[model samples]
Target: MDEDRIMESERHQIEQIRELDLEELQVEEVENLHGSSDDDTSGRAYRDEFTFDAGLASLHTYLGEVEDTHHRLSFLDSGAILNLPLFYLEGVVLFPEATLPLRVIQPNLIRSVERAMSLVDVPYTIGVVRIYRDSFDGRLRFASVGTTAEIRQYRRLEDGSMNVVTRGLQRFRVRRRWIDVDGAPCGEIQIIQEDLPLRIPRDAFGTLPPLTSVSSPGPSHPTMSNTSHIKRQKCREGKNDFDADSEDSFESELSLKEMRLHQSAVESCYGCDTIDESTSSDDEKNVFESGGSQDSVTVGRSSQSNYQRNTSDALGVGRKAISQQSSHKQEKTRMDWIIMRQTRSHGVPRAFWPFWVYRMHDSYCLARKAADMWKTIVRAPSMDGFTRKPDILSFYIASKIPVSESTRQELLEIDGISYRLRREIELLENFDRVRCKNCQTVIARRSDMLVMSSEGPLGAYVNPYGYVHEIMTLYKANGLALIGHPVDEYSWFPGYAWTIANCATCERQMGWLFTATNKKLKPKYFWGIRCSQVADDMR
Candidate 1:
C-alpha cells in the first residue's frame, strides 16, 4: 500500500510540473525531475535530498562553465579590466530567472557582444553599469557596483544595432577607471562575493483588548457579612455620591483613584480580588465624571462664534500640554515631527530656499549665484537690443561645477524658468539692459519664481485649469504630499502651477501646491489633464 501511495504522489508531482509555465520552472526543477521514475516508492525523499545537493553542485558547475565559456567572465577576477565603449546600463538578474532581451546600439558595444557570442557557445557575460551625470562638471559617472550579464539571444537590426537577450550571473564593482589610447572608457573591476543578510522570522503577538473596555470598570462591589445596617447605609451613600460626582469631576478624581489603585495592588497580593473590586468602583466613578466634563468643554468651545477669541488661548495651552506629553512617549516621534516641520518650512531639497539651505553648500551657492546673474541679465537693457547676443550657457560652463553627477543632474533638471527669463538674464549680463517697462522689478526670473496661491481658507481656490491635478499626480506617483488649501483658485505661470491642498481630516495645511517641473514631468504632461485631486485621499 505504501509503495502504491508513493507512486501516486510521484505522478501527482509530475502533473503539477506539467501544468506550470516554462518560465516558472527553475533550473533545478528541470534537471532533477526530468527523467525520474513515476513508480519509485522512495522517489519523494530521494528527490528532495537529491535536488538540494544537485542544485548546489549544479550552481558551482554552471559557474565554471560560464567562466570557461566567456573570456569576460575570466577577466572578472579580483581586478579585472572592463571596456565600456558605449552607454552603460544597470542590470539585475536572479539565478533561477530567465534571460532578458536587450538592444545594443553603440558600435563598440556591438563588437564586444559579437565577439563574446562568437567565442562562447552559451553567449553570455557582460558588465552592467549605472549611468549618472556629474552636476558640477557635467561629466558622466557610473556606479561601481554592476552585474555580469550573459547574452541569451541576439538579432541584428537593419541599422546595424543588435537586439539581444541576456541574464545576470554575478555582481562586480569597478576598482579603477581609465581611458584607452583611442579615448574609449575602460575600467578594472572586482567581483563582489558578499552573501545577503539573513532574514529573521517575525514573532507573532496576539491582539490587544479594545481601549474603551480596558479603560472602564465592570460591575463589582465589596461587602462584609458582619457589617452593621448603618455602616452599610453609609457605604451606599458614598457609592451614590461617587457615581453622581464622577460625571463632573472625572479627570481630577480619576488621577487620585489611579494612585489609590496602584497602592492597593502593591499592598495586598493575597486579597487581590477584593482590592481590585474596590479599585474598579473608585475608578469607574471618576472616569464617568471626567468623560462628562470633557464633553462639556468640547461643546462649549464649539458653540462659541468667535473661536479665536474664546478658545484659541485655551486651545493653545492645551496643545502645548498635549505636545509635551506626546514628546515623552518617544524620541523618534518628536524628531520626526521636527524634521517634518523643517521640510515644510524649507521646501523640497534643492528646489526652494531654506530647505535648499540644507543641500550641499557649494550647490546652493552656485544656484543662488546663477539666479542673481540671471536677474542681472534679465533686468539690464541691451545696447542695440536686436543685434546683441546673450550668453546664458556661458555662466553655467564658467561656474567650475563640481564633478558630482547628482548635482549636475539637478541643475540640468530644474524647470519652471521661462526661456524669456533665461534670455533676459543672459542679455542683461551680456549687453547691460534694464527690465522691460511692463514687468515689475519684483518679478523674479523663472527659476527663482515662487508659484503659490494667495493664502486663504481651504477650498477658496479651485484649480479649474487642472494644473494642480497634474502636479498632484506627479508628486503622488513619486510619494509626496503637498499641504495647505490656503486658496480655492489655481495659478499657472510658464513653467509652474500652484493650488492649495489641505488634509481633509485634520484641516491642517499639509503643504502648498505640488511642484514637479523636473525630469519626471515629461510623460505626465503628455497624458494631459487628468484630475489628480479627484482620486481618493491617500493620507
Candidate 2:
C-alpha cells in the first residue's frame, strides 16, 4: 500500500509539473506547489568519525580523497609519441592518480568505448580533453593539455548504453587531433615528464657533526627548529629558539679579520671572488613556461642554462666554484641539522626564503607543509607515507581539493611536484567560501560543507542526461529559493528527495536541496551544489 501511494503521488506530481510547464515556473509557482509559506530549508549539518560537524566532515571529503587505494599501476612510456583514442568532456579536468567515471548513452560514445577496449597493444586508454562553449561566438573550444584515462571497469546497460570507470593514468600534451570514420575522436599525444622530489638525503642528516658547547659567544644566527636548538644546547641555558652553537675550536678562536682574509684567499684560489649569493643554487634560474593566467612549474634545463649564463661572465669562475661556496656555507655557517636541512638566501630568509635559498621550494619540504595543512584542516587519515614521497602526495591532493575547474586545470598543466604542492598548499589554506561562478554570490561557507562519502565533500556524478557534475554535499545552505515539488527519482543521495535550488538574488539554478524521505533519519535535509557552478571567493 505504501509503494502504491508513492507511485500515485509521483504520478500526480509529474502531472502537476507538466501543467506548470518547467520553463515558465517561477518562485510564486514554487510557493503555490509547496502550498506552505513556512521556510526552514537549512539542515542539521553532518557529523562523522572525522569531525563533530557533518559539514566539516563533508568538507574533508573535498580536502581528502573520495576513494583512496594504494596501487602500483603502470603507464605508457613517457619517451614515446603515441596516437590514442580521445574522450572529450565538458568542464572536466582529470588529474593523474584520479578516478573519472563515465556514463555513455549515445551510440557514437559507446563505439568510442568499444574501440578503446579493443586495443590490445597497451591498456584500454583514451585522452580525456575538456570541451567548453565560447561566449563570443557560441563556438566549441578545447584545451591542448589533457589526461589519459585507463578503463579500470566497464559494464553494459540493458538499454544498450555503456558505463565505464576509468582511472587517469598520465598527463599528455596533444600534438594533433582528428575524428575517425567511426566518429571517434583521436589524438597524437606526448607524455609530459614530471619531476622527482628534491629531498635532502638521510646520509646528509647523519653525517653532520654533533653539537657540544658554544664557543665564546659566536654570532647569534637563527636555527631551524626549537627542538634542534634544545638538543644541541649544552643545557637549556636560558635559550628556547635556535642559536648558532658551535664548539670552541681553533676556527672560532681566530680573529674575525683573519677569517675574512682567509675567506678572500680561498675565493681567489677558486677564481670565484665576488660570487653573487643568488646565483648559486643547484639550478637557480626562473624559467616560466606558461601562457596568460597560467602558472608555470620548472627550473629544469632552462634554469640550468640560465645559471650557466649568469656565471659565464665571471671569467675563471664556474658552477664548480659556486657549488663549493654553497657547500662551504652549509658546512660553516649553519649547524642546527636537527632543526632541519638548510636552503640558502635569496633574501632575508625570513618571510621569503628562510636564511635565503629557495630550499623551501624543494618538493619534500613543500610536501610536509601541504600534508600538515591538510591534516590541520580535517583531522582524519595518516599521511606519513606522503611526506616521504612528494610526487604522489602532490597528485593526490590536486585530484581531491575542491576548487574551480580552471584552478584544477592549472594543476594538471603544472610540470613540477614542488611547484604543484606549493600551489595546492595555497589553495588548501584559502579554501573557505563556495559561491556562484557566474554571479559570485556567497552560496555557502566551509563550515557548512559535509563529507557524505570517503571521496571527500565534492565529487563527480552523472545525471540521467549523461552530463557529469562535480557536486559538493552540504549540511546547510543559504540565499537559495526552492523550486517546484521535490522529486525522488534518480537522486544521487539515496532516500533523499531533490528540488532545484536557485540563487534567490539572481534566480540562477545553482544546485538541488535534498530532504530525507524517512523522518527518523538525521539531517532531515541537505544540499548538493555543483562545484562547476561555484567559485572560490578567498575574500
Give the best candidate by TM-score. 2
Q: Write the per-residue lDDT of candidate 1 for residues 1-539, one digit (tens) a residue.
A: 12234334433443343553233322111111113223333322322231112122112121112322333333244444454322254211112122333545656667767655654432355555556444489565666555566665456767776655455454566777665554445565666543221111100111321111111221122123312332344355443334323422432222222322322322222111111211111121111111223111111111123433534454446545544443333332222222222222111111222212222222222333445564332222222221121123322322111111222223222331223233323333443111111121111111111112111000111122111111111111111123222121122222323333333333222223433344433211210111112211111
Model 1, position 493, has a per-residue lDDT of 24
Candidate 2 residue-wise lDDT, 291-372, digit = tens? 2232111212322344344433542443344454545443343232211222211111112112123544556767878998
Against the true structure, candidate 2 has what lDDT?
0.59
Total clashes for model 1: 38
- Give the alpha-carbon lDDT of every model: 0.30, 0.59
